[model samples]
Target: MAGPTTQEPVKTQQKCVAIFALLCCFAVLVVLIFSSVDIWGDNEDGITEENCSKNCRIVLVENIPDGLYLSMDGRRHLPLSVGFHELLDQAKHSVEVVSPVWDLNSWDVETMPSTAKQGQLLFQRLLSLKSHGVKLKIASSLNNSAELKTLAANSAEVHFVNMTALTKGGLHSSFWVVDRKHIYIGSADMDWRSLSKRKELGVMAYNCSCLALDLHRVFSFYWQLHERDYIPSIWSKRVTALYGKHAALELQLNATQATAYVSTSPDLFCPKDRTRDVDAIYQVIQSARTFIFISVTDYLPLVNRSFRGTTVTRYWSPIDEMIREAVVLKGVKVRLLISFWKKTHPLTFNFVTSLKSLCMQLHNCSLEVRFFSHREQKDDIQYGLNHNKYMVTDNTFYIGNHDWVGSEFAVNAGVGLVVRMTNSVKDKGMTILEHLKAVFERDWRSRYAKNL
Candidate 1:
């Protein structure tokens, strides 16, 4: 019996192991194929499948779906550094940053490193990057970053765009594009407060060429008018060249899938049919399948109406209506985290009161609003404002400078980034909603938050 085909059993076992190894190799090969071809080219762009990866080779969102950690007690959480530095570090040819404010000296405040030393270190890094032959172009309201400019005097090209003159308000976007391939958009400003003190939320789009191209055109809205405040005569080309194609609203790589819309407001970039940040927020709110969670410093939606050419601002609360519909019509849970600080406009509180009263009429987790404030003890250094401006629906997340209003969208130059993490949103690891929920819960339960 022992001699009766014992060799056959061993040969079968060897075949099984060979099959498993081949499957593992096949799995890895598939992952590499998709990762390398994340960015798609227009078929007519003469990009054959063989050469597509060679030209526009890009990456996908790989970092843990967390954000730049904020530390009040100087105990930095996961992601100890502002991840933008990593983007800068990887830039090979160019780095373009459009920030409303830029101040290295702002890092000189107490707590972590000596403010001066931190500023110097950051400045040295900037100059070093520039010296390495990277074309560092910064469009900031750098009217005050004299120290930063001194270091990059010979290397970086610094331009100050007076946004108030270009648009109705000053430039409010704090975003950066590295090599015109990736983007980092968030509530954090370029100053140090946004780095470690402020409650900031931002998304890093890795190898998101379509979204990055849209934002690049948005940046061009300010970039072309360099050192000038007037719109150029042929400015339309700048937008048309980039946004002419029908871009995809959703993108995927491997098992990870994300839907994104790169939006800007005041509607200055494209034609009449283009998407605006205000409308994007309404879409996200109206499309919520279960819950809507929002954290913003302000929440007053005002529409400017013109009667016989005289413009008058009227209170328009579409977001409030969305909340009411989500609660009353769809039975969706709505929770809003609004920051109440000294600078909070008085009228915003009135609107909040109105919402609270409406919530009193509903129940079953219909609507809940919380106020978050920095606890001002005797001399605990003033923690930055809860300056985050973002909203998360059950299946989507929107982050931008727009404050859920028409006025900020109509007057201010701002941006909104939308990410749709559909059914697989509960995947736990890099699911955006999972990460956002954690941040919202932490803020909602903090000692500073009060349910009013």
Candidate 2:
């Protein structure tokens, strides 16, 4: 009778272990479900146009040729050569140039400089178009308050919007729409420094209908807020509308050939529950297969090390999580080209070192990360910084100005478009891949193989 009682206790323990195993499986299933879908509702607009035609093809340009000078010496000088003028004229006519500054009085046209000295000339042409009634709008960051005021005084119709107020981060995206049919996105600002000082990259696309409309929507949203001088409580409603509703989500997900994911900061936008787009980036990292190429201005978070002091634990940082997922599980190739500059935040240094350590850890894991600095004759050029944020995966591309770093609670706002391409529809995939590869090669050569 004593032995029987002891056996009953042992059976109870076995049952407890079985139940624990079942609970673990259930937890795993829940995680898988959340991660598989765009849980934050950022992808709601991605599927709204499923029946929309895939009419646009993305053309990728790897690197702008060094000799491709658009201006020189802060003057409005155009190219004397026929081919240069032809291209310049085409861009001037076809592209609706939007910039923070277009000062005609600043142009010194007497200097017959090369194509590089045509900034003033370009500005003059754009301003002249405004006189003739070509629709053009200029939106500037509040940081350029002086310049904005000057332009507004000169009848430039400039709108001053504090991006930090709207998104908790500075404005950093430079783009132009051409004929409402093509979009140009890059790191180059509409300034002399962008043309010659900074190492920048931009992609131009033609006939991208869905992306064009999306861009228009974002621009219009910002423009509306800018006009009213009223920052919206929530910068994005597309996400709020699509989450938890399967039918709505399905409609959006199935609408277009390419998916769109919106990234915003909760600090600027008032919401009951804040949503961060880093989660979308994590999903992208996990889905990457062939290659992952990142062109970022800053790759490290503001906080460094696994633990700071005693109470702070940075073990689960976003950068760490990204590295682990991209390198450990995916078996995917990773390449990062980040700008290196002196006098940056101390935490950046630690993050850079951490990145280096991660790269070393992945030495046998098929991951490569490299830091890049632009090589120019002037010492000041080194400090110009690479302020572009873009990523290309297999055939998909993401172009934005948001730096992916910091905590889920920290918000860095940016605006850009994500477009998916296939081989059949205009060969945008190949174009992007080729462009990214070329840029990477050029930077690599400049950094490591300059003498070669």
Candidate 3:
């Protein structure tokens, strides 16, 4: 009072300064926590600059092209002038082929005659390698009756794993890695259909260190699993004797240079539960920012018990729950492009119906769900099936052969690669997004000509 109203102004100024300081401190803490935990991006373990090498190019191939030498099929081109024939001829000690099925009459294997032609060729080749003291191992789903029979008959060491056991709910992946150097992964099966009929795509990479190492690890794991209890026959033993234990172990250990993950489905050979992978996928979806894009052949809703001691239905299907969370809670944009199969299995059809119901429930959410049926590009009426299963979110891409449906957890075998793109590289995310959008529009127009 003695100092008049001047003292009151000073006190008010001090309080305002204190409040501002507190706000600044809180903001700093928030930023620190986010940076440490990588809230803005995936942690180093998920992806790193070293893993995304620019030198590694991504080659996209559509339908299978002709004039390439067939490895799995027994029919060889006697007039072989292609690079495939050269690779086959260059085999120093061993050649091993893994396919869904092998037919001897096929041109690919018939060209190279051996005691084992067709399905038997794989076993025969291994045996021949064993005779030369070259170690050979072959892994395949025991579910394939013809292939399994040949495996049982082979004099070479054979390991049989039940695919059903390994993948309680998924498919067994098919791939071949040669000498821990070259790798071939694609949709082509070893059967006649894949070789001559089905539209397929795959890549053969050479001199790619990381890719080759990853393939080697995959093959090694399966080989170890196969050799766990079963002992090779005298022929295989003879071959092993030639290589010596140390050399074989060294080769196998060297093959595990790169870390790789294996996936399989419910088959007689591999019978295990895969709920963890499913949970991991959900976590990825929930954490996504910017956008989420998915193309699948089927969509199924997930059902689980609720905490209330009764069954409660969630608006978003189990597979789409994380997607919904990202869009509705995290402000992410989600787009789903699904194929509507005209002649689908009854169970699958019912599952699709459930998905539609779920989509209707999330209509107000920032998610776009569309079903596509192929319409001919030129002749409108003639159509093909859309059977791609993939997802691209921001700079991360998931390309695989399996559908993103709940049933995938139980019935089908699928494999895919997840790639993280660099900021400097040209991003294909937007390109894929535009392609999906165009396809969806075309299908929508065809579905309801006037309404669209």
- Judge candidate 2 at residue 355 and give its lDDT: 54
Query: Candidate 2, residues 322-429: lDDT per residue as tens digits?
Result: 866776666677777666556334565565555546546454465555665544444543434565577877755566656655632253334444444434332323
**Each model's Cα RMSD:** 19.7, 14.5, 19.4
Candidate 2 at residue 289, lDDT?
75
Where does candidate 1 have its weakest 10-residue lDDT segment?
Answer: 54-63
lDDT of 3 by residue, 107-222 (tens): 45454324114324333444455555554556655545654465456554455544445443323455555544455554444543343322244444343434444444444335
lDDT of 2: 0.48
What would the TM-scores of all predictions be? Answer: 0.74, 0.63, 0.51
Q: What is candidate 1's local distance difference test score?
A: 0.63
Identify the candidate with maximal TM-score: 1
Comparing 1 with 3 on TM-score, the higher-scoring candidate is: 1
Q: What is the lDDT of residue 290 in candidate 1?
A: 85
Distance from true location, Cα of 243 in model 3, Å:
30
Segments in model 3 whose C-alpha atoms lie over 4 Å from true places: 1-57, 64-136, 147-158, 164-171, 199-205, 227-280, 283-288, 302-318, 342-386, 410-414, 427-452
What tens digits encode model 1's per-residue C-alpha lDDT throughout 1-452?
Answer: 68759988999999999999999999987766553343112112232222222112222121111232332233222331346667767787777777776664553265453322333455566777766788777776556667547745757777677665666566777788776666788776666545555556676765656656667667656665567776543433334323311343555532456656667766664432356776677788878888889999877767765558798988776667777777777878888899887656777777777766765655664677898877532122235467778888777788897666567776667877777664573342545566676677777777778877
lDDT of 3: 0.43
RMSD of 3: 19.4
